[model samples]
Target: MSNVLYEVRDGIAIITLNRPEKLNALSIELGHELAAAWERFQSGPERAAILTAAGDRAFSVGADLTDPPEIWPFAPGVGVHVDKPVVAAVNGLCVGGAFILVQFCDLCVMSETATFVYPEAKIGLTGGLITSLAARMPHKLAMEFMMVGEPMTAQRAYEAGLVNQITAPDALMDAAMDYATKLAGLAPMVLSTIKRHVAEVLPKGPSEKAGIARRDLQAVRESDDFREGTTAFREKRPPQFKGK
Candidate 1:
């Protein structure tokens, strides 16, 4: 079976991450397959896409840590540039790279049991992707999720205006598909144009970074701070990030 599954029902394209055993981790193969699937969906008869997972457990546990994908990472429908909407059906833990994926979606329906977090700090990685889209979320909330490395429940995510809807696990896909279908029923050209305008004009991140932050990130990435952060996490200790 394919790691990435794509099927069209009515005018909605349902894209499922088929690796339930691994919590639908995005491997290199899955990433490339997903990219291809997104392309097909954009050009195919489907008017919109509903992204989900195979199991009841997870929408996606994010990128595979043991064997990470390439530099680009696994961004659902990323780079496909589909004009139609893409709605996320988050069923469970949406962490790390997966959190970033949901941020880029036009809309999202998160299961009651779902949680979102950007815990790259625990793994010696940075939230480059999340940072790129941080402007979509509230400044303080986004910073808390990234800096603290704590998972935010679906309800909290919705409260923070991060998730579009919160639904029971059994109804997660249904809710997402309903939204996608409804979006598909609209005038495709107009919807496409509106989405383009928002995407092009929206603020993805800070326009100009403070010189201190830039220097800090540079020094941290190269210095012992980053490594110490990861090591501290693995050892279950708090990280002492020195600005140096």
Candidate 2:
């Protein structure tokens, strides 16, 4: 089965990560598919997009260690900049690299069973690039999560304003869709312009704006270690990245 699935209904395009067996890990294939989907969503007839997953276990376990960055056209900001709108319907564990995906969405509706974390510290890697976007959380709380590598429950995330709403796992999609339907009805031009305008006003720190995300992403994107991670994954063995 494909790692990513795309469908459109009633002016809304829904992209589902299909690798339930692997907790919907963000593989290279899924990345490319997602990039393509974004491009289509931008130019296609859909007025909005809903990103979701197929299984109950994970909205996404995180980025697939096996896939190369360029394998898919999608990157942090490359594939598409729809401005049209994107919503995240987060169910189950939204950990590690998985959180990156949600961070890019316009709005998010998380399930009560969902949780968030940046476990890169556990793996001896820095999460600087992705963590830069975690500014939605309080400075102390964000620092605690990055430093301690502990998981935060969905309820805590909502209370902290990191997430919009929390409901049962089964109701997660409906809740997101309810919001999407509302967004779809607004004036498209007005909504898109507002999003872009607000993005321009947000204060980005010197370090954050100093190409930090680009530098960090480049390190992994071009590393021999990344290749090792993918090879080992394909062989069903743990990766012994050389940090090359």
lDDT by candidate, in order shown: 0.78, 0.75
The segments of candidate 2 whose C-alpha lies over 4 angstroms from its true place after superposition are 68-79, 204-244
Write candidate 2's Cα lDDT for 17-122 as tens digits.
Answer: 8889999887777877777777778888777789999888888877667763432135323234557878899988887767766776788899888888878888
What's the TM-score of each model vs. the native?
0.80, 0.79
Give RMSD (Å) of candidate 2 vs. truth. Answer: 11.1
- Among these predicted structures, which one has the highest TM-score? 1
- Pairs of residues clashing in candidate 2: 32-72
Worst 10 residues of 1 by lDDT: 206-215
List all candidate RMSDs to the true structure.
Answer: 13.9, 11.1
Q: Which pairs, if any, clash in model 1?
A: none
Model 1 per-residue lDDT tens digits across residues 1-79: 8998988898788988899999988788888888778778878888899888888877788889887774233353234
Off by over 4 Å in 1: 71-78, 205-244
